[model samples]
Target: MFFDLALVFLCIAAVSQFLYFLLITSNHKDFVKRYNRDFKEFRPKVLLTVPCKGLDMGFFRNILSLMRLDYENYNIHFVVESESDPAYESLQRIIDRCRDDMPAGFAKVLVAGISKGYSQKNHNLLHSLRFAPHDTEIYAFADSDTRVSRLWLAHLMYPLRNSKYGVSTGYRYFIPARRRFSNLALSSMNAAAAQIMGKSKYTTQVWGGSMAIRKELFEQLNVANLWQKSISDDLTLSAAVRNAGYKIRLMPRCFTVTFEDMSWGQLFEFGRRQMLITRVAYLRMWLWGLFCLLNHFLGVWILPVAAAVRFAMGENDAKLFAAAAVIHWASLIYRTYMRRRTFEFVLGPYGGYVRQLSMWEFLLNPLWLALMLALILISSFGRTICWRGVRYRLNGAFDIERLNR
Candidate 1:
């Protein structure tokens, strides 16, 4: 009776949590249409600070796409470690192209020199901000890996005009043209993060890839100091925003598409690094995520175990176990469906990219779920992580020490 009762509870919990996850993912866009903040009326003088490293896919195209943005009053500041960096030449070409086609002061390329002891991106960004115009009203940050659409800037900046939102942010959708298992698994991992960070009401996580913050609130929170000491710039902004009692919003229609190629080892490394950072910055949420992932995977197989046990014992509750198994599979199927739907909603018109991602993503979605368990396991055991091939060991929430190889 105890086993039977436990099995029943497991099924119930599985279905309930499944529905809760679905509800959270569904809310990613439920409010996308209602926000009416317009960027044109404000016409804020925006400072776009793009701190770049190695130029990945769409290097020149992504940088040049900024020229096509619909917003009128904005300055593009592309910061790099140095002219020696591979990305610098592409950035200079972007600057040269802009100067010939647009006004003389439309774009500026700043070099932060090279740093081996501190975070290079932070150095590039903070130095660039020091030179920003005093009248700069907003700061826009982007990653070089993203392909931003023309309306990306407008959408990301629009909602910040509303006083309630302190930061406007958008995430990236990983789209792979090839259906390699590693690529599909990475795409799945990104989808799961997008739902949690962008959709869930419990927390409003911001992404640095595409985000905008008002200048007043930024200085008011001492963001520069925070960035100087932080491991993840986006999470630092999130912590600061939460401490200052402001919400970070997911901007509608502002999702950037990322096409970075990765192998299985690279994917695992990336996932582990991100989750370890979360474990450092947001311990409670990381614990909760670990528990949920465990429950989700283990709870999924409870019925099969019970059914096998019943069959072995010639138990009379065979039909009950079968029904529970059906509900369990149904719930998992629904969860997979909702994940695809989330891809479509957050990706907007660009969601077709997922369709081309992997047929296995549809038929063998469970493979990614298993890979997620592996991701959680890998993250659970890591103390140090590599960034741009440099190793760093955690000292605290915002501190790290360079690890000797």
Candidate 2:
């Protein structure tokens, strides 16, 4: 009876997840339609602030892409901690090569020192803002690791012309540079995050890597001051926007393309650190993620064992558990198929950034979920996170102690 009940639970959860996927698809489709309706002359004076520490495999290409944005009337501020950083020279060369093509004052790299007791990303952002043009009307932020399209800025800025939207944000999907199992597994798991984050109704959370805010709105909320007091910039900005009673609009086709190659251990450690930050920054979301992890753990690991135990005991209803196992597998496979479609549709002609998906890769997704569950389980007990060569101990969303700087 217990095995049968677990089977019922598994089937129900699978169906619900499928339904959620459908809803997100509908939302994304609407977004795409509106984005393509027509062009508007809503471009504002904008500053794109990108913070860099180390170079990625696509670092040169990524920076070049940013330097060649299709948008008009925008200046870029690339902030590095020191002239000693590897990216400094590369950025200088890009600016020199692209300067003649760019509008006057269009791109400049700033050498700013780090902010003590804060995340490196935020530290760089603070300095970038210091050099922002006095007349800039919009503040845009991007991560150094992502490659943005020519129209990425236009899409992000178009939605914020409305007075009600406090922020506009974009999410990223990862593509593995190699066919290694570790790389495929991690990339497979990351696709689900992009869909949920970009398509869902939740506007309170933003992705720092591809986000924009109106300059007046940012200053009204004192976002720069807020960043100083928080651990993660995205969560801090989200909370401040909510407190100010403003809305966040998720832009369509504004997803950044990320290329990565990592081993299983590196991927696992990355997942844990993310969860630990979530644990401090957004406790409720962290707990909900943990619950989902536990549920997946049961569907993938525990229920099968229970089914086997019942079958070995000569139970006639053991087949129900077997059916549940089949349903779980089908759900994962189908969900992954939908995610691939989402990527291709959004990324468009540039979709090649994400390699073609293979049917066999979905089989490893269950293992990915299991490993993520293990990471979550381990992170639930810890408050310390080693990030970008600095260690931090957390007590709450904004309460943090710098263990190392």
Candidate number of the best lDDT: 2
Assess each prediction's global lDDT (C-alpha) against the native: 0.74, 0.77
Task: Please write out the lDDT profile of model 1 over residues 238-295, one tens digit for every residue.
Answer: 8888878888888756778888778978888888888888887777767877777766
Residues 235-282 of candidate 2 have per-residue lDDT tens digits of 788878877888877776578878889887788778888888878887
lDDT of 1: 0.74
The residue pairs that clash in candidate 1, if any, are: none
RMSD (Cα, Å) of candidate 2? 2.8
So what's the TM-score on candidate 2?
A: 0.89
Q: Which stretches of model 1 miss by more than 4 angstroms?
A: 1-9, 32-39, 102-105, 115-118, 196-199, 315-325, 345-349
**Model 1, residue 385: displacement in angstroms?**
1.1
